[model samples]
Target: MPSLTLADLDQRPELAPAVLALFAAAPPGAHHLVCGLPAAMGQEPTAEILARTSGMLLALSGRQVAGAIGICPYSEDQVTLWGPATAQAAVAEFLFTSTREALHLSRFGSMRALIDTRNREQRAFYRAHGFAAWKDNHLYECVLETRTSTGTVSRGSLAFKVRAATTRDHNAVISILTRAFPDSDHCLPSLAKREADGYRHYVLEEAGTVVAAAAVQDAGRRGWLKLIAVKPELRGRQLSRRLLEGVLASESRRGKRTMALEVLADNAPAIALYEHAGFRRKWTATIMTGPV
Candidate 1:
């Protein structure tokens, strides 16, 4: 068992491939959102994304690579490990070493691995390694294959104007998200980057003001729906649904096959809206936190 090293990820592209292979075998409607990187040479950016945000490491068992994990600095004493898993103890040992290397690279505090709810075995492994349950999240997947539009609701019926977001609409988009979900720490930064990444933002305007908004990130055959928020003053009028439907129809027109998103498990209203609009439960992810 060799110590895990950053060089491993650079040297062995198979590690990511193996992870993707495993994720592809996941249950139907289950989204391996964590492994959303390309399984090719270009995957270096995915690795770099983790390394730059936190730090990354790869674990190897002899000539056969085992697994990999990435850690990012969050708060002063907290580090977030995005993807961490290894089937072999030697590989696990390497994972631990590689994480330490990430800490050295970032000069940050301690680290914890973010695990998915479906990977109970991996979760147990992390617990055995002294990681505790820190945060819980639900992964919802709409069965795009089963989606049948109940016919588009009239925009006039909802009294909301739904339209595609343009660069000119950036300020309004940001304003809606900030006002609708003021405490959603994860979504705010993502909203900022969507514009930067060239994804189109969509808004639902009411009385000349943006009341709800969402963004679509094109993932070839699949599209990611994110930054969904409705203004506080305009909650019950189905504004969010209109915005979501508008985005979905636009994606459908573009020939995208699937649309996916993650929502808080406690948000029943949101879950209902998604269900009503043809989205179904896919999987769940837990956000584990620990002291740095």
Candidate 2:
């Protein structure tokens, strides 16, 4: 193995395009690929995501970029790994270990990597490095065709009433999300930040109370379904499907050509709902985590 030197992306901003190129060439199951991001088809969305990563480290064999990794801090104690992409197999472990050491110097207490299930090499690499399998996540995409309108969709006698969530609905939305995704980090603070970054939350109402809600990230031609949750007691009423349709309708109205989302592989009901809504499974991944 050749000796490698590490460089922080912040100190070497000019190497960004090189890093982007590396990620762009690697597909969902590629050994050098990054995981846990939306849109497996294009580079723009991925680039935008990498641009927001908290820290990135590059492994250099002399002056050439040999490997790289991106870290995104989602919570006070946890960070998500975007990559440990390497140009050669020999430098992979070196890159991953170096990145982990750097993360230990930060406030993060643990790190996670979401790798495509087909990437057995990458999966084994993480496992050998002390990471354990957490959960399986399936990526789904829905392609939209040009349509004048999304007709009045309803279930039974009652019509599903959907609208953009407002400041007044903050508490109600938080309550639902808290119960629906207790382990998720996308709560109040993340919600506010995502909203500020142009992410939209759509809600469904029954009588006067909010029953279901979804968070969407509009990326010009593409949209991402960050989350969708329904009031626990009100589930099984088809409110989830109705709310989903309304969300797709909104994306169609905005002229977005595609929409994507990630759901737990074991979530049969949610998978069935998305499949029924025209979303197709594109990739499956296993989320692995370990102490930093």
Cα RMSD for candidates in order: 5.2, 2.4
Off by over 4 Å in 2: 30-32, 36-47, 146-157, 190-192
Highest-lDDT candidate: 2
State which candidate has the highest TM-score.
2
Whole-structure CA lDDT of model 2: 0.78
Instruction: Compute the lDDT for candidate 1.
Output: 0.59
User: Which residue pairs overlap in candidate 1's backbone?
Assistant: 54-72, 77-292, 110-292, 139-284, 141-280, 141-282, 142-279, 142-280
Report the poorest 10 consecutive residues by lDDT, candidate 2: 36-45
**Backbone N/Cα/C clashes per model:** 8, 0
State the lDDT at 231 in candidate 1. Answer: 72
Tell me how far candidate 1 lies from the true structure as C-alpha RMSD in angstroms: 5.2
Which pairs clash in the backbone of model 2? none
TM-score, per-candidate, Cα-based: 0.74, 0.90
